[model samples]
Target: MQLSGCIALVTGGGSGLGAATARHFAASGANVAVLDFNAEGANAVADEIGGLALQADVSDEAAVSAAFGKAITHFGSAPRIAVSCAGVGMAARIVGREGKLSFDVFEKTLRVNLFGTYNVMSHAAILMAELDPLADGERGVIINTASVAWQDGQLGQAAYAASKGAIASMCLPAARELAQSGIRVMAIAPGLFHTPMMEGLPEEVTAKITANIPFPARLGEAREFAMLAEQIVENPFLNGTTIRLDGAVRLPTR
Candidate 1:
């Protein structure tokens, strides 16, 4: 469906890929809602785009539901487009140098990444189903964020990989279930991108990471990701699949 005159909600919209997507949707004439656990960041981005700001922990069902409700109250209805970009990264081997990997870390990642995506998608789909379908009987579209690690997880990526893999693996079932309601579900498995998640690395480490890309040999930009999100929302046939936005790069086990 066209973005113009629609409402779009983006999790983690305060910065990085989420921020770029929020901006892109706003530019396309959609009313945007910037949702993030970081209240200041969310508000800043919302102010810049003339959109609404919502603060909540995506992993919490009640919090996420309330956030959606607030967004609906502010924007007048559920968003036509919902993008799940709220996630965290942790690097730890199943058995670390000290001992076995901490169960708490592993569980935390899964809760935030996999369960969090589920939380938003479920709530968004519920609201979208209540809306009238567009020309092709399309009510809305959901785009989730995955990672290349899901497919080719390197050493020390057990938790991160499993969480992302859950997202990638759910695409087919979610799309099939939502199809009857005229809502499409899709996921994007991004390669390395320049986001705050990577900001803590040294300059040379960052450079080395991008140098591995096959062709572009550079980190993917957030706007590039936003472009694909727009395409997914506008294209009705692209459903029930996870698109890899990586530039043909399969990371080797480190």
Candidate 2:
């Protein structure tokens, strides 16, 4: 899985983890495509890295298709490596002061987090299957972003946790199914990180969350997540599993 000259597609590549991964991939000699709903951010990243920028909402099939088509046209081929980082975070209790969270809220989270990942992974795999297998008959790799909340969801995290849980759960099955095509599927379940997700929260809440991490006693860097993505892409044996990038933190129910 040498990254040099590899065409990589990263959804949500405008900011946070996705952006970091795109930068790292480009630095590692990969021709990157920065796909994001934020057209400005995507273009900025693309310009910085001398790569392609595509705008699309990952949950929209038509948009995803268009984005890929643009990438193919620009790169002269489909991307073989895809990192799905497009997702949203939400907080709503199943039964709370709001008199039960709205169904729309729950469904939205699932749509963007779980369905979005599936959408990109499926498209990426289909495109990869057309590529001639690299060394060891490997066609490509897909890395999905999950969250530690999938395993230990706190209060008000029913919807978010469910979405992330599904993302993690499907990794193995996808890997198993795609193996015959020489494409590997893996997931990353991140703990508290310095992404916009956390930055958008109140300072007090952020502190309380950071206090729980056992080591480093601080927030996880976006680059750390990107590093693991690189490792997963380079290590052929690493497949069909979700790696927790939480710095040994285990989130407790709030």
Candidate 3:
């Protein structure tokens, strides 16, 4: 869809991939709205871009709904593009040392990563459904964040993998269901990007991780993810699939 002059809502816009996407969308001429659990980060980005900042937990249905409402009210229209980048990457083994159950960790991971994405997508679809269709009868597009761990979960990533795996798994069904309303659903499974989560890792550890990537031989830039999102938005034929944004890196079993 043409981004210029259209409304776009981005979750997790405070930092990382979401922040990059928000800025890119704004620069692309979309009236962007930044939503994040970190009010300060959201405000910072929004202020920088001259867009609206909304603080809310994406896992909370009511909060997500209210955030969209505010964006709609502020922009005078529902978003034609909604990108869900809010999620947790907490890692824990299902059976930890000495058989300590990590059910709590697993549950929270799913709550934030899986359920959070669902809440945002659900609300976005509803609002998009109300808007009149554009070319090809398209109303809106929804992009979700997944991770490579979903497929190659390491030793302590059961929780994180499950959550992201669910996100990737849902793409096709979501796209098919939303097709009637001319809303497309797609998921992006990123391998190892230089996101906030990777920023603090020691150089040696980071190098070891980068060694696995076939080419580029380094962590991906956040802007690269944003670029893919922009492409997905403009290309209507790309739908109902989870695209791997990894640099052809199939992770090892740690």
Candidate 4:
């Protein structure tokens, strides 16, 4: 489906890749909705992009409902593209020298990263199913954020890897079920990228991290992630799969 004049909603759009997506969608002539936990950050990006900003924790169903409703009221329609970028990062070994990892950490990560995606995508798909399909019989596209660690997790990434792995695994089933309704589900597994998640590292530390990437030998840009999201929306045939935006980098046990 063409993005021009479509409505796009991006979760965790206050900053990072999500923010980049909101901006790109606006530039593509889509009415954009920016959802994030940080109201200030969300407002900032929304102001710059001329999109609606809503502060809502993606894990909270009530909050998500309000956000979507507000966006619908503002844009006069449900979003044609829903991008899930709201997630948390965690690092913990099952058994460390200090002690066993806290189950709370694992639970929280899963609740937000996995459950939150479900909450948003489920609601968005329901609304999309009710919309009139395009010439290609496509009503909407749902884009989820995974991580390269899902499959090639490094040391101390048990909790994070498991959560992201579940997201990656969800694509095929969701697409299959939503296919009848003309809604597509897809996921993106990004490698190390220049976002707040990868910030605060020393120069050498950052250098070492990107050294694994075979080409370009640098961190992926947040805009590059957004670029793929736009491509997925425009190309209706690309569904039911997870695309890795990593620069051909595979993490080993490090």
TM-score of every candidate: 0.98, 0.97, 0.98, 0.98
TM-score for predicted model 1 compared with the true structure: 0.98
Off by over 4 Å in 2: 98-100
Pull out the clashing pairs in model 4. Answer: none
- Tens digits of per-residue lDDT, candidate 4, 1-254, equal 98899999999999999999999989999999999999999999999999999999999999998888998999999998999999998777777777875688888899999999999999899989999999888999999999999999998888889989999999999999999999999999999999997888889889988889998799999999999999999998999999988889999897
Taking the tens digit of each residue's C-alpha lDDT, what string does model 3 give over 139-246? 999999999887898989989999999999999999999999999999999889999989999999999999999988889999999999999999999999999999
Residue range 110-226, candidate 2, lDDT tens digits = 999888889999889999999999869999999999999999998888899999999999999999999999999999999999998789889899888889989999999999999
Better of 1 and 2 by TM-score: 1
lDDT of 3: 0.94
Judge candidate 1 at residue 138 and give its lDDT: 95
The residue-by-residue lDDT of candidate 1 on 115-227, one tens digit each, is 99999999999999999888789999999999999999998889999999999999999999999999999999999988987877899999888888997988899999999
Error of 3 at 243 (Å): 0.4
Give the least accurate 10-residue stretch of model 1, judged by summed lDDT.
Answer: 93-102
